[model samples]
Target: MARRRRPKRSNKEARRRAIYLLPNLFTTASLFSGFFAMIEAIDGNFLVASAAIFASLIFDGLDGRVARATNTTSRFGVEYDSLADLVAFGAAPAVMFYVWALRPLGRLGFLAAFLFAACGALRLARFNVQSDSAKPSKHFVGLPIPAAASMLAGTVMMWTQTSLVEPIPAWVAVAMVFVLSFLMVSNIPYLSFKSLGLARLRSFNGLVACLLLFVLVALQPYVMGFALLALYVVGGPLGARLLERGKAEKEQAEQLEHKPDHS
Candidate 1:
């Protein structure tokens, strides 16, 4: 008697599995980059470590877009991405900063690094919860972990390029870490830029602006990267304050217009 053969999987199922794996693969690349950054940092290769973090940032950005484009997004992907982010944008940067500039402060330095990671974890958790329950908005509720990580990485690159003999002041590093941690957990609105439709822009001026930006960045990546991240870090709070002031003025004007004239 011939033995019965096991049923073979369908091509559709195989293809589906492969497609779903794509985004997770990108997430793994990001995680690997972040882990490499930590290792480089420990070995005192800070410039390499900073570059790795930025590499991780690029991978992190691509995974979400790939998932969405392929319509293969799932809860597993979301959670995996968050875990990768906590490593890439949280622990890795903390370790890099701690080793590069925070080591002199000893306990305060390490603690500040830990605080940044913890705040990043909290930020990711809050974002996940909000994404699941709230309507999708054009703004993020707090500073994105990647942006915060990029800021630190940019600082490292910029500092390395500077001609100053003195190391970054301990107080300045500590203050920067503390402020970034606070911003991560704060409620300030940060533009997500998801609604910009950059992929489908129809204007020549927009294309020229983007080309100019690329040229400028290529000319002085370290300086430009730090400057851009710094502007983004400050823009959230400044923009909010400006919007509040405008609203107040508009309300005052409306009240004045409604007032009865005494003639």
Candidate 2:
């Protein structure tokens, strides 16, 4: 009997499918981390749960970059990423916070957690719609859900690890949750840092700054991480306000300069 031959197209299809799975694998890892976070939170392993959420953040970041690099971007991947983000950044953080800090607040605690998750979902939906219709920009239309989650996670990690840090009051935790949830759904622009072009940087000062940042972070990961995330959360509104003020002052100067010689 003649030997049977497999078609070359089948091999190509298999290879393509494998490539596509690479990014989705990262997405799966992120989802698993988020699920693990919730389980750990329930088990009273708050530190581990916080760390798991951070791990999910890493995986979540990698998936999109991997997809882009591999030319495997698809609508399915986009939708999948968003869904995973809601689980990892939205539900996971909410559950972690509720268990670790918000539990004492009773109904108010759970409600704050719910608000965070709901705002995160709404933020993701808005991001998806904007991404499809709007021109690419360096800023996000609202606080990214992952960043919000990371802020909460960083707070937990800092509180758990540092002796100098005081325990957050119940009301303060509730307020923090409410603020983060509002920021997620707000229209304030947040720097996405996507166009920073760090890979293509040639400045020696930039390299030094990057090295210094790494050293600082390495020395006190929990404290430094929380500080950096807090700065980013505050920077959005501060930057916008500064820009608006500058524009207004420039317009005023122009108006004065153009005034007739009535004076």
Candidate 3:
């Protein structure tokens, strides 16, 4: 009687089959934090819930960086991260805003929250389907979902930190939510800070500016963080306009330079 030997799995195939745990672990933790935030908000623990959103942001950033650093990037990981972001940065903030302050606004509040969530979802979908040529742009095609969510979370947190007993007015909440929602799906170009090669900053002034910015943030995080986020939100549209004007002027000058010598 002869026994047959089975073919063994090759190392390359085995590696491919094995999911990389490190980056995905960060993503899972981010997803959990987002859920925890929603639960906290539901339970009327707004402060802690806001902190959880911040924690999710940290984990979200770490996961992508870890994937790149470890050379363990996978399509599976990218899709997983996107799902986590939708929960953490889109749904979580929307829920928190609704539970914490928007509830008092009644129908308007719920609608606003829904708008934010809907826009965030659309933003994520557009990102997933974006063209390769558009992918390398130094600016985002629209306000990033995470940034919009962060602005909401940061505003709530700043209010609490400032010891404000009065809840945000219905009008204010409605306005903020709608503005943020529109920004999410807008074609306005938002600066992609990732395009800045931080590691390659060799200029002394750049180093100084970084240090100063850090000091500014450390001094009054609640005020400064919210201010910075607000600045970014407003800056995007303004920046896009400025860039457009520059381009138009450049084209006009080029056309004049090539015009026939009619004078």
Candidate 4:
């Protein structure tokens, strides 16, 4: 029998092969989750929509880790991730929230959502440009897009799961729209987990804490997610203050160490 010939891969084909599959799959899933969340919101399933948004967050977190682990991180992946984020974290949430809660407030509701979407885009743009030299100090320059979206989603989940009086109080929802939108564009610093890679091992105590957190989340997912998102939103200002205080103390200590002896 004659030997069978294998088809040759072109350079472009070879590059395509290098892209990771599992991670990209996760990314696509995240994008779909976000898209579905929007559909759920429009269908009046606010609870499901909110939950889907959070689910998207999980997928987003997984994609990067999977890519890194598989050595498949690439410029294409990065670009795709950002685009998905804009749709999932920025546009979907804005539209969902506006129609769900903010719509009652008339034009102001949509305006706030619009601001959030615009600010989110700007934030993503800044991140892309500054990713190389971004500081890992105690905080981020602005509220992360994902975090902002999570906050909104978490709040909705909290209200729904807790059987709270209302899924979203008109006043609170309005205020939140403005607050979240501002945070997205503000100069406030927030934590970035990028430096804390998945490989970092925690102490036994930390492991216990993680277990406890898991339990709490399992027991009261709505409350836990709500508290977590709220804490993270507050964490920015708190972290910034702590960073400033630490800087001041360090400067003072250095000055004392270098002071001349009176003797």
Candidate 5:
């Protein structure tokens, strides 16, 4: 009997094998979640759309961690992740919110949603070019696109879950989308929680505070997400200004103290 020969992998097949599977699977799931959100929005299921956007966020977060942990990060993975983010965190949230609240506003509503998605795309592009490098910075250069999307998703979820007498005004939703869009592209320094090292807090009080915060979030998750996003979005610019003012004051004081007494 003749010996059976195994077929060899071609160059393209080799290249395909080089790409990471597990991380990309997560990214695909995120993209699917985003698509599902969009479909839900089209079907007039705002609540489910909001939830899908949140689910997309979870998948998006996992993809990077999985890639990093597995030592399988690659250029293909980075590009794929960004594309998934654009779909999941950019288009899905924008469309979901628009259908939820902005639909009644006509052209203004569509423009607002378009702007949010556009800004998110810009944010993702900037991140890929600048911050996506291996060097970790203390803070993000801009409000992350995911965070902006979360702001939308969390707000929708909050309104849907909570009992409120008056429905949220359409104008308010318009203004919020506009603000979030700009924030996504702004140069404000948003804290990167990934760099915070919360696990290694210096004091017992810090741990207790963290635990208390977790409990609060558990109690009122929708409120907590919305509240935290609001704080973070507003805090970025305020924090930047304060930091600059402090730096200028410190420099001025140092100059005064170092000056040879001119008296």
Candidate 6:
């Protein structure tokens, strides 16, 4: 008999076997959005730049969910997400704010922006190494990069709505940059969205409630964003303490439950 020939594996199958592409592609797009945001800021289009940062935030949020939903989570995906986040949430916002508002403050402005970028990188790196981290708590140990960037973006949007058309005051911009930068790497606890797990929701009402709130916010963005972001910033420490209290109560209950009856 003639020797049997083996069929060649198609490139698609080979790639599917070798790596997860969808989430990585999303991460790439997120990183690109950040870069484009910087370009827009450089061109003096602050509105478009802020919009791009928000665009990146959307993509950044999707990448992880896609990875988990598809059961394609991997170390590569995790690290890539972190790096993309640093660019999208850290470096881009800092640079955009620097050119748009902080640049007028001389060296102080430059240093403030630099500090924000550096702290973002540090925050990401620390997150990566904390292997035993409790399941995404109701809070974070510091200001999440995306939230800090969102606040900056929201502030710019608010400014655009005001009568003061001149560039933001140099001192205020400089001060804000430093404050936000410090928040990025600080030990202060901040809320994480994971406490409300979508998968475990018992009814559609939860989803409906969320959608309605989102609609309201979209209708009045400036005021809503300001209020929401302000609450988010302040809620972190409060949330953390609440979480700790909950944990302690559960532990105490468990201990009591384990005690033997004295008959």
Better of 3 and 6 by lDDT: 3
Model 2 TM-score (2 dp): 0.89
Report the Cα lDDT for residue 187, model 6: 82
TM-score of 1: 0.89
> Tens digits of per-residue lDDT for model 4 on 1-263?
99999999886666545666788889899999999999999998988998888889999999998887877777778888899999899988998898888888888888888988898999998888877676546457899999999988887777766767655777889888788888888888887777554358568877787889999999988888789889989888888788899999999999999999999
Model 5 alpha-carbon drift over 4 Å, by segment: 1-17, 132-134
lDDT for each candidate structure: 0.94, 0.92, 0.90, 0.85, 0.89, 0.84
Best by TM-score: 3
- Give, for candidate 2, the lowest lDDT window spanning 10 residues: 11-20
Worst 10 residues of 6 by lDDT: 130-139
Looking at candidate 5, what is the lDDT of residue 96?
88
- Estimated TM-score per prediction? 0.89, 0.89, 0.91, 0.86, 0.89, 0.79
For model 2, the superposed segments whose C-alpha errors exceed 4 Å read: 1-19, 164-166, 256-263
Best by lDDT: 1
For model 3, the stretches where C-alpha displacement exceeds 4 angstroms are 1-18, 131-135
Q: Per-residue lDDT of 32-150 in model 2, one digit per residue for the tens?
A: 99999999999999899999999999999899999989878767778888999999999999999999889988999999999999999999999999999999999998899999999
Better of 3 and 4 by lDDT: 3
Q: Model 6, stretches more than 4 Å misplaced?
A: 1-18, 131-136, 162-164, 198-212, 238-263
Residue 40 in model 2: lDDT: 96
RMSD of 4: 5.3
C-alpha lDDT of residue 167 in model 6: 74
